[model samples]
Target: MLARNLPASQTTEKVVENCPIVMGFDLKYARAGFTVMQSVLETTPDAQFCAFNVLHDGLPDFAQRLGHLLFDGPRSSITFIDVRPHFDHLELFETRHLSRAMYYRLLIPILFRNAQAVIYLDSDMVCRRNIFAMVDALPPGACLGAVRDNISRGDRARGAMMRDVMDHGPEDMLELSLADYKRDVVGLDNPDRYFNSGMVFFRPSEITDSDVQACFDLCHAPRYCPDQDILNTIFGDRTHLLPERWNYVLTFPETVGLIPDDWMRHHREEEEHAAILHWPGPRKPWRDPSVPQAEVFLEMGRRLDERLQEVAPEFFKDVLPAS
Candidate 1:
């Protein structure tokens, strides 16, 4: 579907094939959301796509700004929908306090209405390979698919934090880490199970009508990462991991040997390949002026955010943050 508002000269079409159509959202991550919308608008007018934003409060000014950024592309045919109106199914979790787990509930209703299967991605990510390949690999009755974390960094090194995060002992660290999961999460019967939730494909039919809400309720109980835990609880064995290239988290620019010099070059290369680029840490290229590769991400933010300075001026400010 295309955006509701677009320039008169622009036109777009929907093309469907053997695979299930794909859907994704960029909720709180508005910058990445707009970038994703632009990326999709650039490449895939013929391919079926949908954009979700749960936080839209229906304010005219907010809606107008979002529409201008997302839908007014050169070849625009993108549909941006606000799912806030249909909050009835999971009203127990208000949008304001919506945890990452509860945040996923609105998608189920959208998925149920559109296609049997859909892949949801976090806004911080950039996509390299075609996402259709990832969606094609899921088996029937499965609700999710993803790639394993690219770097394990080894168990012992991650032990201190992982132990505290999972509340497990040294012995259980391996199990908790699922350091072996890439080898065993799917019972060792099917090898494709240890994907990172940063990128995932899900089939709503596989999720019980009540399961989405149940997962949200589970969030208040106990958790390290609410989203991951809810997904692990709900989808479990049905989830599969795709290859890593689909959602490469562009690591801090320093590690790539470019440091000060190659930052922009690497950032450009990543942007070209990525279906989505997941900027996982707090050192956002937009907000951190000190980062060597800050320019590209900063430019990206300028395009995505209507009020870049107001929302995060430190992002565009010439001076770096004080230590």
Candidate 2:
């Protein structure tokens, strides 16, 4: 951990009845947030959804209209936090699938000092769980609760190299192995302990400026999965590792046979029971038709377009399901 100053920008708050849930995204992915949030709302309507402008990307034009039509658009709803000043200076780390927005949730503790507990969800997630109840189930004094990622729980051999663009092609892809990098940088002693940053609940109690500084220090350089690595390094032993169902990674061809065949039957059942389905890495279901649950996610976008077309036809001029 190191010492650093938190940004002085004030957060915009809109009061909600239940749990305060935070999501980070820019204008490009704002539509994805709408589809994902609407899907979650279908299951759990009381959950408060906040759009975090991590890069100070101005509010999406459709937000005000959607405020009145759908979601908690009425008064005392949908808190919007402007975190532009905080991240504007940094050279953001991103891959083909990830964006600078991936780094936004790291500063949640510093930005949201008032909330009792904050839930951070990536825009790419689609879920059917009562997330608020999940927050309630966290053990006392639990700072955070998250699922073990595909790497942490599924396989350790896959950790040998990161499947990411690192200014290196296939010729030198294994130059810096992920497991070796983690062991050296964060002193990662236990291979099974690394947790993903995508879906997490933070019950912040005494998070100090120093802890926030540690987040800043970690991102000073880019790794394979920049934010995921930083969060694992900083949270260390504090993360309450939930079951694999909390954030199950949708299987693609490359990931299908990796899990042993004996457990494939169990894995299929696990998929049906997954609380939140995550489309991690470069290939996203919304964009790539080959993904396992691509239709399930695209259907969400189609449904979102249909409703908006009925009420706000202008919003769907470009069409929601269109790539």
Candidate 3:
């Protein structure tokens, strides 16, 4: 039986009093972070929320305003960590849409030393269920728990793309051939079962400064997805594969056709019960209102707006229309 289908009575009822959820964001992704945090707070209601801002230029002001809008009566508190100093030595990879802050996710263990375990989420994702349920399901001895990157599993071309990035040295990324990537990068016998780094239940004790440093070092290499590549390289086999419902990645019909049959069947079944809805790729629900899952995000945004209007109408007055 899938974890998502487990009745509420059977689900673990442990109240996660201090479960810390760390999210990375910048000015560009501030709104997405708010939606993510809002969704989590709505679902968990009692967990601690922390935001790590990679851009320090106006973080203090943003954090103050965000706190006033989100944290009303102390049901949950948001902690803001300025990660500018950490980014000084690290490389920031930026494409047209993706930001450098995505790489900062790997630094969660180092940033929050006191936390035994931390939940790291990309700002583009929204929690649809109580995340503590996933946290409680972490298997023993596993350093990290995450869902398989079904986008890669469903399509051979996508798998090859991942291999191209992983196998080639930073300087040789463009020279990739499918045969060489299969034979040299990821072994032929090993199917590409890379997990998405967007939503992770991580045990901080399993990570070390050296591990963090190694990932950062890999960032300088010629890689397509920096943090994701490092995570797949380091914790690929060590990670415990969680159910797809825990991190249901949104996809369109065209992409869905590319996914393998078995994975597709599983995706269809688990999607309805998804605990977190992850908007990967360029089409974010917040940005493009036409997206299939746009309503989910928009509804959450509306709910947040109403809450803000009730609690702090002055702050709500400055709210910009969702892009």
Candidate 4:
């Protein structure tokens, strides 16, 4: 199935033979993506890793080199596909937190048509466990699997008139009443149906090229959280909500009072112990080291710098230091 919105021009350097575990990001987050790759190499060393990178200011030199590092017989291979031309033409919504790269996961079906499934991840996440095990448990006929954005889910069920609101979520939005917005803009009554797009198990066979087109078409409208809105609108109903540990957004205690106690009760696992520690929001560990989970990313980045130094000295010398 040739996805109409999928990128046709790609520079490939040995893509994986089977369904790949993919991550997409622009050049600005190349370091962040590398940090994620480092964590995966440390924990899930055997996983098939591919990066659908949007290039700017030339190729991501260090990121590409780390992809070729052969540990235990392709224990970790990083394949990169250039995804610039596909999205460059569109004036998609974007902000300090959301990049155009966030929308690239929609291309999974077109990229790997024959594969049963593919894993997609945001660049800023820290992987502590082999999440492939979770995919094995995905129910037959499920189109996609992801953790519910607890903060997003709870707000819909929230009784209080005033509550901490998430952008483009179940609240008064774009001058529409809370009821009308959720029903109209989001096209959902039950917030439980919404899932964070940070990490996803995308089943290519369950969807079609039009689903991919729908996602791209949504990009025309500007919103606070563009890619997320597109995803929830297109794929929410058929989604299988996974265990929270897979995405563990890591916002509970870090930014105090951001997450309500009741929400915490629903998701009991602590952030540090979770499978994938994802630090959303603008203050990333690299930019602002004071964030709660910053150390997890910083320490690994320090080590990643060392690993790169060992592999290719001239390019990565004294880079990737802890913030």
Judging by lDDT against the true structure, name the best candidate.
3
Rank candidates, TM-score, best first: 3, 2, 4, 1
Residue-level lDDT of model 4, residues 235-277, one tens digit each, is 8887888877788875544333344666566466444347777
Instruction: For model 3, give the RMSD to the true fold.
Output: 4.4
How many pairs in model 3 have backbone atoms within 3 A of each other, for residues 3 or more apart or on separate chains, i.e. clashes?
3
TM-score of each predicted structure versus truth: 0.59, 0.79, 0.83, 0.78
**Candidate 4, overall lDDT?**
0.64
Candidate 1 vs candidate 3: which has greater TM-score?
Answer: 3
> Ten-residue segment with the worst summed lDDT in candidate 3?
1-10
Candidate 2: where is the Cα deviation over 4 Å?
Answer: 1-18, 45-56, 63-68, 73-76, 94-98, 151-155, 162-165, 168-174, 259-269, 319-323
List candidate 3 segments past 4 Å from native. 1-12, 45-60, 155-171, 177-191, 311-321
Clashes of 1: 21
Candidate 4, residue 135: lDDT = 66
Q: After superposition, which runs of candidate 1 have C-alpha atoms over 4 Å from their true positions?
A: 1-14, 17-28, 45-65, 72-102, 105-113, 150-157, 161-194, 252-275, 289-323
lDDT of all predictions, in order shown?
A: 0.46, 0.63, 0.67, 0.64
**Model 4, residue 298: C-alpha shift (Å):** 2.1
